[model samples]
Target: MTAMPMTDAPAPASGSRPLTRVLIANRGEIALRVIRACRDLGLASVAVYTAADARSAYVELADDAYRLEGTGPQETFLSIPALLAIAHRAGADAVHPGYGYLAESGEFAAAVTAAGLTWVGPSESAITALGDKTGARAVAEAVGAPIARGSAGAVDGVEEALRIAEEIGFPVAVKAVHGGGGRGFRTAADARELPTAFEAASREAAAAFGRGECLIEQQIVAPRHIETQCLADAHGTVRVLSTRDCSLQRRNQKVVEEAPAPGLTAEQEQVLAEASASILSHVGYVGAATCEFLLGADGRLSFMEANARIQVEHTVTEEVTGVDLVAWQLRIAAGERLPEAFPAPRGHAFQFRINAEDPAGGFFPSTGTITACREPAGPGVRMDSGVTEGFHVGTDFDPMLAKLVVTGEDREAALARSRRALDEYRLEGVATLLPLHRALVDAPAFAGSGHTVHTRWLEEDFMPGWTASLTPAEQNGAAAPAEDVEVVVEVDGHRLTVCVPAALAAPPAPERRRSRRISRRGTTVAQDISGLTAPMQGTIVAVDVSPGDRVSAGDRLAVIEAMKMEQPLKAPQDAVVKSVAVAAGAGVRSGDMLIEFED
Candidate 1:
């Protein structure tokens, strides 16, 4: 195991209100994950769900369930008051903010503690300090860890960003001060792209993290993304489980992860462990956390930021280290001491995220009920999912369907296991990343020297041109009808549920909401220059041009916020704006016209 220093904080007394119940303030896979952890620890789990997730698989698995009245996150998961109320009603002794939504919210942590509920995470002060990208950079510097050369703190405006961009040179990354999973990251190769990148990054940051603060850093060309997994108890004992290589990514979001990252020297490993331990110790962080760093081609390691909560890829670490990270979080929160040190790595482990996206169609999100489902089984293959055969994937939450983790004695064996697992995984109704993962494991580049591939290799080099052939209908822009949906409606604080048979099917996809176009076979219709239409469903956050405005082919005519990313709608050709069809804050669908241009 990775090494660190010892501490003397006392454990909570055995008689001090032992935690027997936990309320999960999240949804989907992570909620199920926490419930399983609670079960393993002989504790009961309560779940909270929004109207959109009333039938989620995880909610059904929890010991008890409570409904929060709303659809989107703001009215459900992100609502601190609503979550606390559920805890009170459920008689929950603690709350587990599983991974997204409020997992890293310092305010939520403070609120949970103030409500006299145990929060299964680090202290609020630590969350506030390390959760802020800019603040974490400062902490890294103070702890003698190397950090990238860039802005000293959060950038305020375009002018300030321009100055920082000049100082950091070209090919700079505009990153949110409180973002992860690449949700709030953008790169600008030159000054021309800086303004758009900065604004989009800031907006994405605000939408995802509720903070628009950003910082500019020089993009480390072709660097490897590595992180150290840490488990610390209230007693100040912090143990590093293993290093994970999250180099396989798309748009900064990790796609594939493995433990004991390939191609690192002993010295590199030592430095990573030391750097992670130093930061976690300095902040007095407790529970589960991970310290991220970027390893450059020259072998220099620069601290990126710290995830103050257990990360999505923690399973890879668990696979290699034989440690239960979520259980550790619960134990540490209950003031129990961890083992003095964790065991050494036993085998190589790989994790592939199964996202509900159509890789053949620009990775667009696909939502529908899973008509059929099957998963890989047997030794060394594990699936952690909150989805099943009848599960309905929706747009109100993250697109991930589940995670597949596999282990073997070595990298080659692990790759073989992963290939078998991918082959065994079968599902119908919605598209997934399964085929992409299948191709990667079989590719010679990924099997041999490909082990060291960088984050951009997949999307930029391979995936764009890869064959995701499924059916002529799917490729030629014909989508199967959405299955009939049955919903449970609440009336007078009572439950009323309605079920519709799949054969009945729902109405033809709304006239203005064509779900997809531009498939792998390249058969989708071309856009009409006389009118501008939304490319996908999202909220129109801005209209950049007005009627009668002249614009070039490349001008950004508008911006849409969807899935927490800011997508720019650009002009297809030089044209004069005839009319603005949609207003700011309007809800739009893929085929909804947003602007009209002069013929």
Candidate 2:
């Protein structure tokens, strides 16, 4: 692929304009990351937060902190005016949007630039051109990068989506034109699934990015998710720093990632590097960006999309390449030039996303106060965390609590180190993926240098019979009666616990047996046999069942939107809905009744 002609872009900052202060328009670990970078450069950092994050670590670490008065994301971090106002009040000379929220919004970038503050990312024009999915595809096509067949641009509606899906063949992906981090991405195996997928993708895109427009593409079957970390300067230089494999995923979200994607041939690496550089240079993109691709088992590469801002897995690339991508984003925004070449990647690195989710329960988002936390540390291990003991994890935003990255001289060594790090890590009062991470590091499909895993490996293969074993804390994490006797046991590597009457354990028959049952099922519907209740906190986006409606097992009864993803609540068995307890758009708690069934 050859670099195409450049588009109109903002003029480069005049001769290395220095930045004195930077406003971080985000929350959590990323905000703390940018604050640390600002400190490294001797630049004052300003932090903004909602009521939920008022006492977050990032706020206290920043040089100045302000509050954005509101509860939800729209009223807080996603509000451009609110962020700009904070920047103005803090006398911030630059704005850094650390992933998610308005990070990929061209409007936000333009607004910051219009306010005379440097935008620490690609130029607004670059973002406008490439941030949009359809525009990105067009750019890729112009540069002759390999791309999957799909619609030219956003489809008109579900009908149009169906038509496009058919023309491109079934098993199409409906993707949001804006945003990243898998917020608005869905796959439909056939026509029966396309409508729901389209609607869900659009709704999520609109809510997450303030844009509902979506484009359809032919789904790549069982491909490794590969991406290249790229850096660009205003002086017409683009560097493809490293390749990363985010093949281990669930719910279309990456769970594990590594740098210099394993098992890539020399030719594949060359193609990825060239195509990424060409695409960014063609759009006059500046600062840090990532170009993603799908590598088929047959050794073919297909362009996926370009992320305009830094990504969650940049840590893996940094570990292997020894580069601080966030600091480079700041330097590039301040008119610094990139070196002609970056050092070749070394060794191996892996990043495990420590999400506040219950792996045993279909990765459903979990929230609670962090009653205890023990982060890992040692040679070749780094923990980028956002929460602390006493910090409350909520469903109002992404459930990721932190990133655990480990590196070593090689892939095998890295995997071994990851196992140790995961064992050292611990948390309480909230369900997490820690046990899953511990298991994944040693799984046959993920371990060793010759491992074969794809984007759907976790969902399709690894999780089929996999179950998460609870720690002693997790077993006792929930409140229980003082009279309840808890007994824990392990059978065939599966942990099982029971709290029952004292007589039951005495080898004698009791007049009555009272016990609490535990089930490892998807946490969208209640476990009760008579009715369905919400298993987590969220808002009901749709109600597919009504009173007297007949439903069979596995039929979607409703959908709950939480943590920017939609989880479908399904009927547990054949039943007629006797009554509906919750309406669409209603907020619900863990035990709130959603539907009732007659005996």
Candidate 3:
């Protein structure tokens, strides 16, 4: 297919001017990422945080910081008025919406411009055109980009959805017109499942994005999720970076990303890169953008959607290409043109999203204070994080704790480095995806082969005990099967000894008649003192109260250090500290009691 040329006019000449201050309109790793980029460019940075994030590392690292009211996205991060006020107050010359929470919102982009601040992203028109999946598909088709054979517009209801599903063939995917990140999407194998899938998808889309309009598309089975990273400038210069394989996902959210996807033929790579550049330029694209494509089993590529803002996996591209995308965004927004030609990617790289989520517990979100976060450091290892050892991991925001990126000579080297980095990583206060990532990198399929969107699902169904077996030593006790005999044990490090139950010389057998009754007594007793147990594996940072100190409920007793965050252990009820088993600087496990209190 012949590609059309981009028609956007060149950006005004502002590259010569130095950027003085930048405001990060987002949080977490991405926000910290922008701050670092600004620092490298010799520009001041301002971080806007909610009450929950006031203690975040990003706030402390930035040149200036301010608090936004409310704890949630709607009440703070997504509030345009609040963001504008912050930018004005901070005297920020530019605003970078790291990604998500209005990153792709055209209204937000326009508002930033209206407030006389540079929006470090694509043109608002381009964002609007590509933000809506339906509109994006139309643009792609108009520009001769390959698209799935399905509805050309939004499906009105279940009846319309059924018709489109039939036309598109069985196993159609219903996606929210304005959705990303896997929410508001459902797949149906046949007509029997269409009604339920449509209803569920619409409801989810509405609840998540406040938009119910959905479009049905033929589900591409065994499709590899590949995306092209492109950087464009106001001068109409566009460069297509390497492609990334983000096929390792769960529920549509990417968990692992690698650049220069393995197993791609020279021709296939050329086709994708050329098509991506064609589409972006044809739309007069500017700033940083990612054109996502679903590479089919047959080697044909189809348009999925175009992300108008910086992506989470952009780090993988940066590591391979040696390009600072955030810096380029700021320059482009300041009216800089891309170099005569973009630099070619040099090596293989990968990025793992380190999240505080329990893979064994169905990937449930885990929250707590980080006590001792030890990030990996070495050649090709880069840690982009918004947290330190004393920060709190709150439930009010996304569970992502940081991103671990590694670069190497080739895919195999990158894989090896990733494994080594994962080994070096340590988080104490809460469960994280570390175990799952370790299992994934070690799996035969992952180690020996590239990936597709369905890869994680296949592994999840087949590798039942993979992640369950690698539970952190802190979570190991929680995963232990019920025990009987009511034995009190003294545990130090990995060693354990039975200290209680002097009447019993050995642990009771599982099938013994008295085992069941003894189990109840043991459970009750354990529960009573469980509160005294260390909430996670960490070193004691402080002991606010000592033995014999009378304390009311919620009084701070001690602080634990894990994953670079501080967790304060508080008294559960009015009581006197009878004995302090641990002092400041002592290390503890999840079930180790640090203090004893008198009732």
Candidate 4:
């Protein structure tokens, strides 16, 4: 639907401002999405990049680009001052925070408005009301939306959390008050697991969102993850565009999502749409937002939370509904009003996130340069990518390299298309989720007619039996090079099809190789396999073992934080800790010694 002219209706707190140049305070595919939207609206787009992201695809496509002048995220994307200064330098009249980073930061929104620039999102007050989990829950309750039993507010400590969990029953979820994208979300099956889950969740929350306060909620076991894509304008119009199913997850994070959630009855659809519109309307929210819920086996819907920004899976909705959600964010911020109604959902679409992770290695994050890249193309295939061939995938950011969206006339057709698209898609250089996605399309649980998959189905039912291998890039770069292709370089008069021995290959290219002494699989500590070593580059978040501590095989020793996920290092064999080398918060590279085992 087209936008109507601005009227005398009461506008959102962020009043309409003239649109010209828009600065995107984000990176990767989402930034590219916003840039294309700006171009479609005849507006100039400005891009900001960190030192590591200088060669990203979005930076090159932007009308103007500015260097963030920083080494990491804290000094670049998460720095309010840096982003604002770049906005001023670019002469941008508006700032669009594509999802993540400071996208949900109310302070950032207020600061943008204070600087007399348009914030292309919900008003500051609206974000503040909904950004906090407790406030969002209250709003949902006030609006008569369905909700599950949860703590009154953010719990004080583990004791308080346990008390709340007891009151709500076991099998509960510990969620960060300011968490999104499943960063600080954890689950507990019993009282014994609550404390560790709580502490880890809080530490992760502090690292990701700068807040440690969390709330406890009753877990809806084995439920389908459903959310409604809602859009509101300054003129008080809220439209529920479509419903999506994001139940296929790993470690509480979504991997595959489909638009127009399948198997929902007419009543369930009405409930989702009504509740979504009511929650946003109650908060006087403007711009795009999502209301999440859990549909139980009994067909009851329970409110989960609300996200105050565009989501990574929003592309599937756009494909099926024929609505340009990103463009609407720009137009709505420029004082345009939404029409009375939106078109009904048309076709079915599925989105697969291609993350740089090794599924066989327990989804370990893999870092390497993109040696080869090939995307799929057909009537119903779309690839939104941030990297090109030769672009390096590192541990500095999220593991998601791109998204693959496939659409068809129906769910069956969409699944068929997804199979073709996934097979046709080819990417090398780093390990990714391509293999797992290929397996998912044909899995009995996923392709079954009754929709048997749930939130925990991936880890509990699927992954335990599934297995994949390292990509060619993983073996070539992270380990020793594969057998060299023979070529004759006239050496003395002899033409030789020489194959360089693996032992003689250039010490395994420093930048590409993970560790000099560790094995290719990162299981052995050194050439002799005498100690434990880090498997990837990341920060040590926790060290459970100390010097002189005796540990058995498979005992937890430490935890490493990389690509926003925590990986626990376990003792490979029964041994006494001879010494400890790394401490919590220490940065480490692959093959770096962490603890030495006694003889």
TM per model? 0.86, 0.90, 0.77, 0.89
User: Judged by lDDT against the true structure, how good is candidate 4?
Assistant: 0.86
Best first by lDDT, ranked = 4, 2, 1, 3
- In candidate 3, how many Å is residue 127 off? 0.8
lDDT (Cα atoms) of all candidates against the true structure: 0.81, 0.85, 0.75, 0.86
Candidate 2: Cα lDDT at 269: 94
Look at candidate 1 and give me any clashing residue pairs. none
Instruction: Identify the runs in model 4 with alpha carbons over 4 angstroms from their true place.
Output: 1-14, 469-528
Q: What value of lDDT does candidate 2 attain over all alpha carbons?
A: 0.85
lDDT, candidate 1, 453-559, per-residue tens: 77677767676556554222432355544333444568998997544444443542221111322244331123577877876677888899999999987677888
The TM-score of predicted model 3 comes to: 0.77
The order by descending TM-score is: 2, 4, 1, 3
| Predicted structure 1: lDDT | 0.81
- Please tell me which predicted candidate would have the highest lDDT against the true structure: 4
**Tens digits of lDDT, candidate 3, 1-599:** 12111123244565323456889999888888898887776778899988777778788889899999874567788889999999999888788999874888889989988988888888788887888799889888888888898898889999999987887798888888885766667788899988867876776666556687899999988678889999887767788878888888765667888897778899988888777877788778788999888888898889989888899889999888888898888777767668876667778998889888655544545677787778999999999987878778765566788999999998788889988998888777766777678767766565665443343453354335443433334122344333324343555655443322324636442221112222111011122432466755666766777777888766677766554334456666677878888887787876688888775
Candidate 2 per-residue C-alpha lDDT over 1-599 given as tens digits, one digit per residue, 9 for 90 to 100: 12111122233467445777889999999999998988877788999998888889999999999999878888888889999999999888889999975778888988998998888888779998888889999999999899999999999999999998889898899999887788789999999999989999998888777789999999988999999999999889999999999999987899999987999999999999999999999999998999999998788999989999999999999999999999889888877778778888999999999898877777888888988888999999998999999999888898999999999999999988998898788787787888788778877778855778988889988776555543323333544343334466689989986665554555432111122224366444445878888888999988998899998877889888888778888888889899999988899998888899988
Clashing pairs in 2: none
Q: For candidate 1, give the lDDT of residue 550.
A: 96
Assess the local accuracy of residue 316 in candidate 1 as a C-alpha lDDT between 0 and 100: 90
lDDT tens per residue, model 4, 507-588: 4432121222222333212223488888889999999998899898767889899988887787888899999999999999
